[model samples]
Target: MKGPCTPCTTPAALTRIGCLCAMSCALACVCAPLRAQTSTFNGAVALSSQLVDRGLAITPATPILQAAASWTSASGWSAGVSGALQTRDPGHLSEGLAQVSRAWSLSSAWQMQADLLYYDYPGNERARLFDRTEAGIDWIYRDVLTVGLSATSMTHGADHQPRGAADVDFHWPLAGHFSLALGAGVAQYLVSPYDSYGYVHRPPPGVYGYGHAGLFWSHGAWRIELDRIATDPAVTRHGGNLVAQPWVGTVSWSF
Candidate 1:
């Protein structure tokens, strides 16, 4: 498959199962701090039926277990770290992330956030295993809707060209302790010059989309979510495309 993207570093093909799983949540965790009024820290745990990103499962069929911690300042800045482990027997570290972000109020109802994140793998050291760096920006509305765009380039790896992505999301309170959430996103893939384990059939420069709907519940410090997820073209690898519908259950607490 493909290698990672790091400038001046050798780039690989398009095998993202590992890199995407390890870094996406790690980087995304930094955004949690934007809501804190003063210095605050919190942690949570989660389980997912599949490790999904850009419309594909990075994991082989096993569930993914996740944990994260974040700290935020009243002054529009935050940082966080997270880790995920795939719970198959002899389970190994899936991914770890470290990220930081800052936000600026763009009026009483809109805000802009910028982020930088790094993806790390503990012991995997292939010439193609260079770590990844990601940067993104988000436009948030009334703290319930978000529009985001991002670009990432390999920091030290091979020749993976820069990638672009965008997404939109909305969450609304439906009743006491209940809420609804919807999201849609897409990613653009660069044409790979190297062989892609037979996945190169999608012409060159491919794009993928994903969508999801979820029900959320909050009681005391516990937060939970159940989501129905779908993707287009699914994937050609693994069990050959995805299931008709997949859902994930997650529970977390903030202390």
Candidate 2:
């Protein structure tokens, strides 16, 4: 599930220095697993040149700083938080997210996951309610194919309708440590007004599809990916089926 929102800024700031400190802590946790059937923690930093969510371009086609930390239990329960900041002044938007998920192994090669995601924006909100909350599920087959469906609703002084989407993703291993990933999903607006939905500059009661293709490489705890992504019934202001950014690339480490 995907939705968008923005909120007022915090009195203090979390600069790059702060994020680095958090990442260091996360790495330490990764080495010292916790109890509860086995627990793991990991962190990563990413420089994303384009930020797109559910087919909407929340930021310009410039690099953005992102960081994340997550811990998972061997019993399939997990919790994590992540944050993103703009690279320059007048950035206007910054966000943090908290997530909780529980997964189950159905068989030797099948798994199911349920997730709840909350998004909070910090900075000037212009007195608009844009916070969003999403709950979704995913099914994975043989660790290579996945189907996901989810519903997203608003919170934190935002609209109270739900939007939903269903997506399937395929991952195929290539030579060496590289792999290919392809996916597409269609979304429906369950209950929303006709004009202007949170971050979706499009009319409500709309149904549209989104797609992505990417190449991935993995070595140890490090991963790198380059992708091209697009969505249909794109916001008219963007002038096409794709947002201002059609390309995105990322490099991250688990620890």
Backbone collisions counted per model? 20, 2
Give Cα-based local distance difference scores for all models. 0.52, 0.54
Alpha carbon deviation, residue 176, candidate 1 (Å): 3.5
Candidate 1 lDDT over residue span 1-255, tens digit each: 111111110001101222222222222233344455568765656655554444444445566676666666777777767666667732566666676777777887877777676766453221124346677777777756777777767655466677877777666778889977677777764323123233344443356666667787777656666767666553333223232236655555544
Compose the digit string of candidate 2's lDDT tens values, residues 1-255.
132211110100011111221322321332232224567666666566655555445455656677777777766667778776668733655667777767676777766667677776666242123356778777767656767777877665345678777777766889999988676677774333223234445453367766667786777766667767666644444323224367766565555
- Cα lDDT for residue 204, candidate 1: 36
List CA RMSD, all candidates.
Answer: 7.2, 7.8
TM per prediction: 0.74, 0.75
Clashes of 1: 20
